[model samples]
Target: MDNVITVRDLRVLDGRKTLVGPVTFELPGGSTTGLCGPSGAGKSTVLRALVDLLPHGLTRDGDVEVQGQAIRYGKGDSALRSTVVLVPQTPVVFGGSILDNALFGLRHLVRASRAEMRDRVEQALREAGLWNEVSGRLDSPAQALSNGQRQRLCLARALALEPAALLLDEPTSALDERSRDTVEESVAALRGNRTVLLVSHDPAQVQRLCDRTVSLEHPETLALSAAAA
Candidate 1:
C-alpha cells in the first residue's frame, strides 16, 4: 500500500517553547492507524500541523508530504487540506438541514447541479453510516439530530470530499458507550478502503480500530517516538 501522508521529524513550537514532536510517521493508503499518547503530547497539534493549521505563534519544521507532494506552509495553503481532511473532535453543525450540512464544504469545492450534489451527499452519508438513519429525514434541521448523529454528519461531510487521508481527532471521546460503539462501527467499516489516522485516549478503541499504532512522546523525552507506525 502507498502512503498518503508522510512526516519526517515534524515539530511544533510556540515561540521558544517546544510544544510537540520531532514526531514522524506515515499513513498507509487503505488502512487505519491509531495515534495515542499521554495528554499534552501534541497528538492533535500534529494533525493541525499536517494541514498547515497550527495555532497562533506556533511554527513547525521538518517535512510533511501528501500524496508525494510536499505541503507548502506559507500562504495558508488549504489546497492540501482539501485533499487530506481533518475531522476535529467537536462536531460543528451550521444553520441548515442535515443534507445541507453534509453538502456544505463539498459544494464549495466542486461545481455540480443539485441532483448531482444530492447523489454525492447520499454516497457520503452511506459511507459515514448515517444514510439509513437520516435518509428519510435529510430535510430535518441539523440541530435536532443527536450528538452522535451530528458527529457522523461531520464525518459524512468529510467523506463527501473523497479525501486522500482522514485525520480523525478523538472521534468518539465525548460520546456515551452506545454512541461510541456506533461510531466505532462506522470507522471500522472504512478499513482497507480509506486511510484513517484516529487519535484516541482509549487504548482498547485504538487496538480494535487500528491496524498499527503510533505513539507520540512528550517533548521533554530524550527522543521522539520511534514506533514504525
Candidate 2:
C-alpha cells in the first residue's frame, strides 16, 4: 500500500512541556490506523498537530506530509483542508436542516450542482447509516437528531467532501455503548477506500478496528531513546 500520510521527527511543545515525541510513523492509503494511550498521553495533541490545530503559542517541529505533499502549517492553506478532514470528539452541527447540514461542505465547490449535491448528500447519509433514521426528516433541524445521529451526520458532512483522509479524535467517546458500536461499524466500513487515523483510548476499539497501533509516551523519553539510538 502507498503511504497517505507521514510524520517524520514530529514534535509539539506547549511552553516548557513537551506534548508529544519526535515521533515517526506512516499511515498507508486506504487503511485505518489507531492511536491509543491514556489521557494526557498526547493522542489528541497529535491529531491537532496533524490538522494544524495546535493550541496558541505551541510550537511544532519536524514534518507532516499528506498525499506526498508537505503540510504548510499556519498558512491558512486550503489544500490541507480540502484533502484532509478532521472530525473532533465533539460534533459541530450548524443551525440548519439535516439536508442543509449534509450539503454544507460541498456548497462552495464549482463542479457540484444542486442536483448532484442533493444526490451526494442522500448517498452519503445512507452510507453513514443515517438515511433510514433521517430520510423522513430532511427538513428538520439538525440539532433535533439524537447524539448518535448527530455524530453520523458529521461523518456524512466529511464524506460529502470526498477527502483523501479522515482524522477522527475519540469519535466514539461521547456515545453510549450501542452508539459506539454503530460508529465503529461505520468506521470499519470506511476502510480500504479512505485513509483513516483514529485517536482513541479504548483498547478494545483499537484491537477491533485498526491494523496497527501507535502509542506515544512522554516527549523526554522519546528524545532519550532517539539520542541513545
Candidate 3:
C-alpha cells in the first residue's frame, strides 16, 4: 500500500536541546496508525511538527513526506496543512451555527456554490458519524453540542477538506467514558477509508483502533541508550 505520510529521523528541538524524536513511522493509505508513549514523550509535538504548527521558539529536524512529496523543514505552508489536517486534543468551537462550524475549514480552502458546500458538509458529517444526529438541526448554535459532538464536529471540519491524512492528537482524552466511546466509534468508522495517525496514551485504545503502532521512548530512556552506546 502507498503511504499517506512518511517520517524519518524526525526530531523536535528547543534552542540547542532535543525535545523529541529521532522518531520514524509511516501511515499507509486508508490505514489507522497509533503513536503512543508516556507523558512528556512528545507524541503531540511530532504531530505539530508535521504540519509546521510547532509553538514559537521551537523547530523540527528530519524528513517528512506527504503523498510522496518532501516537506522541507520550516517551509510547510498553508497548502501543506490543508492536505494533512490536524485535529487537536481540545475541541475548538466557533461562535456560529453548527453548519458554519462544519464549514469553517472548508470556507477558507475551497470555493464552491452554496449547494456544493452543503453537500460536502453533509458528506463530512456523515463520515465523522455526526450527520444523523445534526441533520435536522444544521442551524442550531454550535455551542449546544456536547463535548463528544464538538470533537466530532472538529473531525468533520477537517474531513470536509478531504485531506490526504489526519493527525489526531489524543482525540478522546478529555471526554467521559460514554463520550470517549462515541468518538472512538467515529474514528473506527474511518478505517479503510481515511488515513489516520492517532496519538494516545492509552495502550488499549491503540490496540483497539490502530493497525500498527509506533512507540516512543521517554527522553530519559533515549538518553540512557545514547550514553550506553
Candidate 4:
C-alpha cells in the first residue's frame, strides 16, 4: 500500500524534556490508524510534530513525510498547514458565522470558483452532519453553537480545504456521547480517500476507528515491553 504519511525515528523535545522519541510508523492512504496511550503519553505531541506545529522552544528530529514528500521542519507554516490539518482536542472556532468559518480557508485560495466553494462548504457541513442544524442560520455567530456543533464546524472547516491527510488530536474528547458518535461516524465515512491519524486515549475508539493501532511508550518501557512480547 502507498503511504500517505510516514514517520521514521521521530523524536520531539520541549526544551530539555524529551516528549517522545525514536518512533516510526506509516499511515497508508485511504486508511485509519490510531495512536493510543495514557494521558501525557505524547499523543498530542505526535500530532503536532507531524504538522510542524511543535510548541515554542521545541525541536524535532527524524523524517515526516506526507504524500511521499518529506516535510521540511523549518519551512513556511502554510505549506505544512495546507497539506496536513490538525483538529485539536479543544476545537478553535473563529469569531464569525458558521458559514464564514467554513469558508475561511477557501476565500484565500483562487483554485475554486465561488459557486464551487459554496457547494463544497455545504457538502462538507452535511458530511460533518451539521448542515441541517445550521443550514438556516448561516449568518449566526459560530461561537453561539453548542460545543459539539463547534467541533463539527472545525471538522467542516478542515474538510473544506480538502486536505490529503487529517490529524485529529483527541477530537472527540470534549464531546458528549451523541456528539462523539457523530464525530466518529464522520471519521468512519472519511477513512477511505483521506489518510487519518487519530490520537485518542479511548481504547474502544481506537479499536473502532483504526485499522491498526500503535501503543506509544517511553523508550525504556517500550524496549522492555517488546522484549516481553
- TM-scores vs. true structure, each candidate: 0.92, 0.89, 0.92, 0.89
Worst 10 residues of 1 by lDDT: 220-229
RMSD of each: 3.8, 5.5, 5.7, 4.5
lDDT accuracy of residue 130 in candidate 4: 91
Among residues 3 or more apart in sequence or in different chains, the pairs in candidate 3 whose N, CA or C atoms overlap within 3 Å are: none
True-vs-predicted CA distance for residue 46, candidate 2, Å: 0.8
The local distance difference test score of model 1 is: 0.85
Model 1 residue 127 CA deviation (Å) reads 0.7
Q: lDDT per residue, candidate 1, 1-229, as tens digits?
A: 7888888888899887778878878888997888879988888998888877887789999998889988878675556656989999999899989989999977787667889888889999999999999999989999999889989999999998889999999999889888888899899999899999888998888878888778886322121233422
* Candidate 2, 48-147: lDDT as tens digits: 8887888889988899888888887889876677678888898889998999889887885425779988888888887788899989989999999878
- Per-residue error for 66 in candidate 2, Å, reads 1.0
The true-versus-predicted C-alpha distance at residue 57 of model 4, in Å, is 0.6
lDDT measured at residue 74 in model 2 versus the true structure, 0 to 100: 87
Q: How do all the candidates rank in terms of TM-score, highest first?
A: 3, 1, 2, 4
User: Model 4 compared with the native: what TM-score?
Assistant: 0.89
True-structure Cα RMSD, model 3:
5.7
Query: Which candidate ranks first by lDDT, i.e. highest?
Result: 3
Supply the TM-score for candidate 1: 0.92
- The weakest ten consecutive residues by lDDT in model 4 span 220-229
Could you tally the backbone clashes for each prediction?
0, 0, 0, 0
